[model samples]
Target chain A: MHEEDRQLVRTLIRGDAAAFRNFFDDYFPRLFRFILRRVNGDEESARDVVQSALIRAVRKLDTYRGEASLFTWLCQVTRNELADQVAKSVRQETYMRRLVDLEDDPQARGILESIPAGGEAEPESVRQREDLAALVHAALDYLPSKYARVLELKYMEDLSVEGIAEAMGVTAIAVQSLLARARVAFRDVGETLLPSLGGNW
Target chain B: MDTQPDPRADEPPTDDLARLIRRAGRRPQPDPEMHAAVRAAVEREWSAHASHGGRRGAMVLGVAAALAALAIGLSWYSLHPGAPAGSAEVGTFVAARGPVHVAPTDGHEMVVAGSRLNAGSSIETGPAGYALLTVASVAARLGPGSLLKLNRPGHVELVRGRIYADSGSPSAPPDALVIDTAFGQVTHLGTQFQVRVDPEAMSVSVRDGKVLVSQGGGRSITIDRGQGLRVSSDGEVSRLNVAPYGANWAWVSEFSPNFPIDGRPLSAFLSWYARETGLTLVLRRPVTQADLDRPTLSGSITGLSPAQALAAVMATTQFEYDMTVPGELRIESRATRGAN
Candidate 1:
């Protein structure tokens, strides 16, 4: 929205390669750092998300009305791309579950066993961690989409109550109410699925 | 469904819990090379858009070309079945394992090593069985429980089960490569790919090069290397990125036929090995084409797949190879020559 960024946008849209290169030098590190944190130190994913974000940014530069700082716009693109990746992974997990839902065929389980646990962690520990994460993901899946979205903003994006309210176009009190209900439902689902964790947590 | 927030409890995660959330986001920065590569890609996209007049024009041209290719492939597969394609024999079977059989339109017969197959021949395998046959320079591995019939119109019909096909050498024309499935037609250009057809859905995973996957009526999508698509019977397609050499491809690796490198030029051997393993052989600086051409590798790779064989053999040679991308094999020639 600044006058300076608006001029840069005008230059970028005019097919000025030098201007674009300058923009890349200015923004690549900032964008890469943001995506790196979001992807939990997964360098490969950070690179992919940043590349995709930059490509979209370049292609849609003409449509950039300079309503927000260019970096903010780029971050929004990266967030959407990261969400797409998560949803894709969820779909793959769902598909794999459906593949051998019959009786948990040992042959299929053998294929899954080959997946490395990373670092020096034991396979059993990794499996336990994955199992807990799966349970949490399942609980989240059971919540209404609106409820899940609020919780994701609160937890995953680390947005504040007021920020969540602003993002959801609601009041902070309403956001508080939504978060409380989401947590309760998430707990109920987790309890019905795995009771030991329910009591301990 | 009852929809109401509890009146008694209106709360959020405590400050400590919020700290936990923030901790989740703490991650180390990516490598500088990765950032540079991404920046370069953005520049390339911008240049491409400018060169093609615009992204819209480029996309239109790409879609038009894709549609033309798909139409040709669909017409190729829709030819009459059981018709002989030129001479009866495409090529002789170089290797076969377990109970491999070929059932013609009239009767059934067992397939053996060096046995030639014709258009009417329906190749099959029983439980815990597989077959590897070389049809031209191209090598195809028929996995267990597969039934394949070489069709008349220059395509192989996979009735069901899995087939790993690698059209050897990028120079070899893709004139004879078409895999017909119930869901669609899969054609590739000197590539390594696997087509698995079950009773419910058909999946095509490309390891290298590009594959034209046509679901008929001009509906086709070009799946590039490291990408896979699963098409349900209702023509629903879901794509996933493929790690070609990962555990997901272990079964395919187990079925790879022997690639002899003894008394062969290093270049030819590497090209064949890379093609079979779905790797694009890259020769780095100091490793010229002359090195690939002149060096006559004198070794034996008996039972290993292309990837394993490359590892074991490259250790004995001056060249070192690594998987640079999902399906690329980059060979780096070291400064100190020979096995050091």
Candidate 2:
């Protein structure tokens, strides 16, 4: 997959139109899954977020400085657009306020309730993985913007430390330090929010 | 909780996990539809750029065609002003455009196509195999291996390679033309001039009037007649000279009898002036700095040809000067020459 991505990047830089087709064929499913996690399993919002990221990648094609691999840069762009979507959603207050509306419809609430809150669930082992995932998400919310962004790009986007450093315009050491701090903070939050996941680790 | 292992410790197992987490953070796979959309966008962009190239090419070709017709008409007019038909053919051959304005040292001639000169046009081949053209309205520097084309009297093109022109010769009879080098277009006026163009250094020397030097990259220089400037390949313009008018043309020819001067040390003054003018002033023998200092010189560098100017300077000064070749000049202390 890495070798294929590198080839796609080389082709794109040379202005090959077909390379983007291959890129979409190879990476779209994974991109959609990443967006799904951020959007709390809302298929529609996740799809919209992924589409918007792809569109932005098209527009900002020329500014690709090649300091980071194409995949890492694309992920950064995607994350920025996702953050913007979240900010937009927050500003509109439509999503947060709609939680009350969900209670009135059990059918709608089922999907919402299925994804547990910050805490509170049974001791089922199968649900443990999902709970841990939820705890990870909750901890991510508590991180400062800089640390969270570095952590997301490093872990979620799979960007190299060198790539993250280039994206953030900092030295590799700074990125490494931020990542270390972010990991500790995340682990602390996870231990507090979901003791089961913490004990396993 | 506090006893949790550091996730980012440099220890092997922790480091491996960190690397794995880093890998996981990369962007997910792109969707098929998204890839198609991006490719479509790129194609559209490339096609748009190609069309722009086409339109620009058409515009250039149109302008060239119109100019070529005008050139042919001018050649016909010059040849057959109601005389015999055959007389017009003598100067009617087409001159190819080249990257250079001056003829090469190996006997290549630059063609000037249908240009009108409103004032003085002086062409001389000087040091370093470059041609210096000082016309009344234009000052041009023609580099080696170039062809200069002047069309419709005012339009000049440096065909093969490089030329520097301070174009704007003078208000003409609707048909005056001059071009020194292709790098910049110049129209001459009653202007003092010096132009130095070689493959390495291309410049325009302005003696008296104004010249507008414009290159392809939108780089331009507006030079008053007494100044000299250079336009580099990257479309950057640099001012080369802004001193006295004599200082500009001093190196184009030998130090003529009519070199202007104030009372300064002869050796020191000439040495400084020669350095600026690209002239070689050789001494017959080594002399003390004292002999050169306090040797006040007063002279007029006007109206004399270069050789006459040197002779005049020699007769007046306590020192004497003579030229051995067009490139080399020798100066000796008259007191020293007589004493020796």
Candidate 3:
């Protein structure tokens, strides 16, 4: 956008290491700080995101059409990468939470605590978990791949609607609509069949 | 139609989704070692590119090298190349010199190549080549000199290759097909199974669940638990009732002589013990899935690292298990082994 920025871009395109060094040194801290706020005080994660954005920019240097400012492109890439990581953490949290929920449920907790800690899964309980998982899986299978991917990216990956749209190459509004539709589909299927499978939908 | 309501109506549309999307956009920085490795890779590329001199020459050479690698890479397909009808697409194929492109034929075709296959998409190789294909969600590690074909009706055949099929759940179809030299053609029946095919002996290891191994000449043997089978290429199937501890446990077990527990199942545990103690456990009968999943017996057998602990358990318990080999014990006693 600016003459100086355009010059920097030309230098980077030419593979000038000095230009890259200047760019990296100047922008690295700003990018790190920006990432830090997003990552919620995880210094290591913030550092990771900033470095990744820089490396990606370097790799795809040829693909830069200069349609958007360098800053905008970099920010776009940075957001996508962070969203993917967040989604992973979210999925882990959800799964572990589900496992914990089984232990904390008023009725279930009594049955669970009856056994020693670190003990084997009671056959009945294991069967129940397995059965529930199977029912959930079956319902998941009925949904389209796009919906599944969106749900996974959202709830599992904790990606924002805009982030999903970007990764999926769709409009943010489209993602919103898709999520709405997907929930309806899930809940409809859950109500119709999951209860019959003896699972609380 | 009026009775059908939207699931998302209760939850208002929010901007958090967009924020999450923006957040996921951030890139992940590589570890210091990875950064160093990437730098090294770049340096290597730079050196190779700079060697030729001139910008055009460097660019041309770089592109050529990349294309060649990609072409050599063309031979290998990571996933199930299950011919989903219609015209067969050309997946990657790697060869001795480099990678080649192989398209599926209407009938059978074989291609010879080298280099371990790193990945694939719906691609299966013939028995003549070695590959690791990731079809569907499962990653199947193939042995050298094996013929594997990919078709919709179960990714068809593996004529002679050692394969470890990490087939994804039962809901998903079998991602790979294996025809072991020792055992018969075995489909991925919702579990990880290894088939090793060699001249003197061929064997099948059912890592999880059961594998119905059909012998080449139409006979089939169902091997479950830690059991395996030895069959010749000539189609003579010899059931190896011996618990394949060494073979099964090598990858799955998380224990050692020093640390005691390595997070492997009994199959893996038995395999590791066999390897360490130079003994084999010949089971009088099979262990049930319920027995295996019981957790008490499945995980690391605590204090069993020392012979004293083994003897103590033996002396205290009514469980009848005899040491078939010096260190290997077969559970012959009906009484359950005491919970660890």
Q: Write the per-residue lDDT of candidate 2 for residues B1-340, one digit (tens) a residue.
A: 1223344633342353344344333433333334334334433443233222212110000001112221111110001012222221111111221111121111112224332222111112111123334333444444333344433234545444334433333442222335546456554444434444433334666654565665666665677745777655455567865553232343334222122456655665566445334356666775544666766777554444445545655576677765545534567778777887
Candidate 2 on A31-100: residue-level lDDT in tens? 5655666665655566667677867776556566667656567667878878888788563365455445
TM-score (2 decimals) of chain A in model 1 = 0.45
Highest TM-score: give the candidate number: 1
Top lDDT hit: 1
Rank all candidate structures by their DockQ, best first, as comma-separated numbers. 1, 2, 3
Model 2 chain B is weakest, by summed lDDT over 10 consecutive residues, at: B56-65
Clashes of 2: 62
Alpha carbon deviation, residue B217, candidate 2 (Å): 56
lDDT, residue B60, candidate 3: 8
TM-score of 2: 0.25
lDDT of 3 by residue, A121-163 (tens): 6667565654554444444444554565676677657667667
Off by over 4 Å in 2: A1-7, A65-69, A89-91, A97-104, A108-127, A131-201, B1-340
Better of 1 and 3 by TM-score: 1
Deviation from truth (RMSD, Å), model 2: 27.3
Q: What TM-score do all the candidates reach, one by one?
A: 0.42, 0.25, 0.27
lDDT of each residue in B1-340, candidate 1, tens digit only: 2234456334545543343324334223345345445655776676554432231210000001111211111000001122233546655565544334443322112333565666666566533346677666668888766778776545788887788877765665765678899999998677778888876578888877778888878898888888999897766899979866654455566555555677788888787776555556777777888888887777677655556677777777678776746667888876643445
True contacts kept of each: 0.29, 0.11, 0.04
